[model samples]
Target: MMLYPSIMKLMEKTGSRYSLVIATAKRAREIEAAAQETKNVDGARSISKAATEIADGTVVVFDADDADSADEVFED
Candidate 1:
């Protein structure tokens, strides 16, 4: 996804770690499943009190639509 490169660049520039949060109206399982399909995604966690944890200094990457050829960003 176009956002991936920017997100990665931000991470590199800030020297910070990151996480992904899926906020679609879809079921949590579906969101997790979609994230599971992504490499270097780390993993998906509930967005409860973890919201603050997720909202830390790290940058949040968003994909307006389903992720497709965007996976190339994580490639060597």
Candidate 2:
């Protein structure tokens, strides 16, 4: 049912579908963990939120060379 971000839009940010999936999943997990700690669940689901973040440029996929700093790409 999700449609705002659009797959093509997300793919444009991420070079490929595989990369997109990886980035989204990782962000979703982070979102879920944070929600658990704060006991808050009033926003979009983690998967959708992660996709939205990619579309909005709040998160990005880093190249292997930058793997060491990959965790820093996500911003609140």
Candidate 3:
């Protein structure tokens, strides 16, 4: 079966399988929380939506090691 936003493509952005998983899960949680507050459900799975965002470059993984400071760990 074909996977939209294939894992390899996501790894290209995240640099590793582990990083890709971390980034995807974090974004998915954010999407879920927002949906809860807004009382909105677009009928799309949170995980898939998050993956799409990463694939489209709308979301990114900010590695703490690559940051200039501790506070710069995560970015929008």
Candidate 4:
């Protein structure tokens, strides 16, 4: 069958091309390194799993606002 979620759909979730690229690559590495613990089933390639997670919104991409808030939490 065709891919479950189109690239555009995944891109929309990420918001920007650079963010999409960064998120997908980081997720692919996570899947490859921890396939059993990850949402991806055994034998699935990392890239596919990454794409699927992005489409499903399982991976949250933190932007500048999120980072600023995070810093506030850690600051004295």
Candidate 5:
């Protein structure tokens, strides 16, 4: 239930609440892992960092049904 307004925008982009949750949770876990492995991480909490990443378009979320679409949305 990370209900930041900015994060709501990301939810709209993903077109599914479940997808947004998955993305945010995954990013939060990464942030936590990074904190464990290093210091000087700018002092942002993992949940906040996750929301900011979504709001800033630094991360993209895709629905489970959209596997093919994911490739296009996330081109290398």
Candidate 6:
């Protein structure tokens, strides 16, 4: 993924209060490693599980296949 200035801007705007969960099965380790390099974002492997309990309201940002899994997480 191309690094974008707007993403950093959004993170700065939100501050450390929000959790940033990256939902990727294969790249979980890499994602976590990269997230560690970032100063204040909390990273996790499971998007569905993490989304339900984010300190702030969750933002589910993922690729197409993972989007379908959100229904399972958010359904009543």
Give the top-scoring candidate (TM-score): 3
lDDT of each: 0.40, 0.88, 0.86, 0.78, 0.78, 0.41
Question: What TM-score should be assigned to candidate 5?
Answer: 0.73
Per-residue lDDT of model 3, residues 45-74, tens digit only: 999999999999998776658766535544
Which digits, one per residue and each the tens of the lDDT, describe model 6 over residues 13-59?
33432323332232345445566787445543433323332323344
Clash list (residue pairs), candidate 6: none
- Which one wins on lDDT? 2
Cα displacement (angstroms), candidate 2, residue 42, comes to 0.6
Query: Compared with the true structure, what per-residue lDDT tens digits does model 2 show for residues 2-75?
Result: 87899999999988898999999999999999999999998679999999999999887776777667756444
In angstroms, how far off is 38's CA in candidate 5? 1.8
Q: What's model 1's lDDT at 60?
A: 34
**TM-score list, all predictions:** 0.23, 0.81, 0.84, 0.69, 0.73, 0.22
Candidate 4's TM-score: 0.69
Task: Report the candidate with higher TM-score, 5 versus 6.
Answer: 5
Give the C-alpha miss distance for residue 29 in model 4, angstroms.
0.5
- In the range 24-51, model 4's lDDT, one tens digit per residue, is 8999887777856665567767777788
What lDDT score is found at residue 17 in candidate 6? 28
- RMSD values for the candidates in order, in angstroms, are 11.9, 3.8, 3.0, 4.6, 2.7, 12.8
Question: Candidate 5 lDDT, tens digit per residue, 1-76?
Answer: 5556465587677777777778888999999998889864787689788878877778776677888988876686
- After superposition, the stretches of candidate 3 with alpha carbons farther than 4 Å from their true spots are 69-76
Q: Once superposed on the true structure, which residue ranges of model 6 sit more than 4 Å away at CA?
A: 1-57
Model 2: runs farther than 4 Å from truth?
65-76
lDDT of 4 at 13: 86
Candidate 6 global TM-score: 0.22
Candidate 5 residue-wise lDDT at 61 = 68
Stretches > 4 Å off in candidate 1: 1-46, 57-59, 66-70
Residue pairs with backbone overlap in model 1: 1-70
